[model samples]
Target: MNDHDYYRAFLHAVWHDRSADPLVASLLAQPAFAVYRNTIFKGCVDALAANYPAVQRLVGAQWFQGAALAYARRNMPQDASLIAYGDGFAAFLSGLEEASELPYLAGVAALDRCWTEAHLAADDAALDAAALHAALAAGQDVRLVPHAAARWRWEPAHPAYSIWSANREAVETPDELAWRAEGALLTRPVGEVRWQGIGPGACRFLDACGDGAGVAASAALALEAEPGLDVAAMLGALLQAGAFTSFH
Candidate 1:
């Protein structure tokens, strides 16, 4: 094999701990390579931990680190660049049968992942109240374009928002089990990620808006999802949160 091919083989052997295999050891000594391999593995573990703090809190740091280690071993990041290292972690958590008992765990991981993505996403100008008011006054069809990084959806049985928020604070952790499934939105309006729980109606409205539905149609969808929901109030709340970038 060429020198380039040999180097690639050496790296794989070291990273995968195949150095003990006859084919690998023939090229490099095992003891020297093992040290470098351990460092690389630990670095990946640390990166995952830093990326998923809320998950770490939910599962406890020790258990989270352990899981991160295992996850890294199984799914060594394809990219050498660390900026997007944990991109596939939500899927990893979802497929882990051991974590299935905490169904919300995957959701929590997803929310955390979304937060990271939102933070790094391209910046956008926020819509102002005056502009929105004028659109409303003119009776122009208003449609909100949420930030590209925003994630809005409803969960089936987990208070994913509550767990994420409560864990971020230094206060006592709240009882996640008591929380019923709720709709939530995560956004980054000014370089900071924020999470908030909204009603089913609001979620539906946001989903509609996200899909290019007009304001009126979005409101109607919200009301359809929850007959008792106050469409006017929810719209006001979303506007105040700077959830929309523009009205079209």
Candidate 2:
């Protein structure tokens, strides 16, 4: 094979199946290649641990690393940047037989993924409360959108948000949890990632807004989820959370 083709096969073997590539088949028995392969595995595990700190903390280092290694076997980083290594980790975890008992683990992994996405998003000016109010006062249907760094998730199956929000900073689990469906809102409004446990009303409202619905329509959706929801107060809270970008 040509040098380029040989190199590609070698790398493919390192990342995937050694026996599957002609070049890799030749190097598998070499001591140097073996060491290099182990190093790559360790690097993938390390990258996964960094990318999913919340998951690592919840599952502990040994268990987390074991799972990370397994995940890396099937899903290696497509990009050179290790920071973006674990994109499908949550979904991967969800399918793992080992993680079946821990129903919330995959959700927590998803929350961690959201935090990473928010942290890495391009900076954008969030719509101030005054600006939003002014556009509404003018009786105009302006296009409003979630901020570039805004990410939210709502899951009715498990209290994933509560557990993740609590364990995000440190490994301090709450003394007691209500154990119900929960939602989380993440934003990097001021160059620092922030998160909070949100409610069904806010979740539905954000969902509607993200679908390009207007203010009234979004409010109706929120009210449907929560009959006595204080729509104005929810807006103010979301405004404070930097959930919106500049209105057009």
Candidate 3:
């Protein structure tokens, strides 16, 4: 076999089949090799811990570490950079026996993943209010363009947003109202990640905009989601949150 192919197989054995590989078994017999393996395992655990702090806090450090190790063994990182690791962690948690008791845990992990995504998204300029206003005035139908970093998705199954907010701020007492289905919006404005729970109307409006719908059409969608939705207020709030890059 070629050098690259040989090393690739060796790495796969080290990562996934150490016990079965004679070379790995020989290495396992050495204390130094064991230390190296332990260090690699710990690195994976630490990266998971950092990526999912809310999960770590909820499950306690020991339980979280055990779960992290198991997850790492099952789903090794495909990316060279650890920063983008743990994309499937939420799904992994959802399939776990322990997570069955905590139904919202998986959703919370998913929400946390959104934060990472928002933070890592490409930076882009936002449309000035005056420019947007001028475009709206000139055009019969204006379509709002969303920022590259902006994302809005409603989680209806569990209070994922509330749980995420509580853990993010380390709240001593969480709001009871937060224990319901809510819309989550994540964005990066001025190079800092910001996220909040938005109203259903705003969620629909944002979704419509993302679908490349015009303002009038997006407003109709928002109204369908919430008949009493304040069209002006919803638009203003989204604008203030830096959700839109331009309107044309």
Candidate 4:
């Protein structure tokens, strides 16, 4: 191996407590190596804590740190940028035995991940309602697409959206949150990310848009999914929220 490769191998062995390299086999047990290993693991834990602050806040720092440590040990970052780390952390939480008590924790963590994605998404001008109307009036077959910074999902089994929204920046939650499924829509309309809870129909409408449907078709699909849904209002809300961009 080259010098850089050997150096990385040495660090990996130290972190994993493996004698993978003959030259570094003896050094792995040394005190300095242990300190480096611990520091690296601590950094991983810290990144996870920052990435999933809602999870940490929900469970408290001590418990979150413990869980983070376990997650770090098994799932190291695949990229140099720690910001993109913890992609599967919500699934990891869902499988943990201790996490079973908090049925909505994994879903909350998933929304937290969505927020990060929307925040880091590329900048673009959102599609204005005027432009859409003009295109349709001109008889153009214009497909609508979600904005680059848009992220949304329909959690059909839990009130994940409500729980996540309430607990994202604050420790407080609703006094009596309805025990039902919810959906969420997140987008970077301006420079910062913004979010709002949506209904299943809205989620389906966004899905249809993502699947390359025209705005009218997407709204039709939404209404098909929910017969009583106010698709016009939903479309208006999404337009006002800067949820769509012209299809590329």
lDDT of 4 by residue, 1-248 (tens): 78998878886785578877877878886889888888878988988888888888899999999999888888867887788788889999999999999999999999989988988899988787887777767877678778999999888889988878877868578889889989999989988889998988999989988888876787788988788998768878998888987753
The alpha-carbon deviation from the true structure for residue 172 of candidate 2, after best TM-score superposition, in angstroms, is: 2.3
Q: Report the lDDT tens digits of candidate 3 across residue range 1-248.
A: 67786566566655775655565567666778667766777888998988888888788899999989999887767877788689899999999997798888988788778888888899889869887777777766888899999988787777788887778667643655546777889889889989977988899998889899999999999999989989988888888899988877
Please give the RMSD of candidate 2 to the true structure. 1.6
TM-score of each: 0.84, 0.94, 0.89, 0.93
lDDT of 1 by residue, 92-192 (tens): 99888879888888888887787778777778778777888888889987888886767776877888777766665645566445768877777777778
Q: Compared with the true structure, what per-residue lDDT tens digits does model 2 show for residues 1-248?
A: 78898877877788775666655697886888878988998999999888898898998899998999998888767888788788999999999998899899999999999999999999998787787898888987666699999999998899998788777888577778778999999999899999988899999999988999988889989999989999989988999999998766
- Highest TM-score scorer: 2
Q: Whole-model Cα lDDT per candidate? A: 0.78, 0.88, 0.82, 0.85
TM-score of 3: 0.89
lDDT of 3 at 156: 77
Rank order by TM-score, top first?
Answer: 2, 4, 3, 1
**True-structure lDDT of candidate 2:** 0.88
What ranges in model 3 sit over 4 Å off? 19-31, 173-178
Error of 4 at 66 (Å): 1.0
Measured on C-alpha atoms, candidate 3 has an lDDT of 0.82
Greater TM-score among 3 and 4 belongs to 4
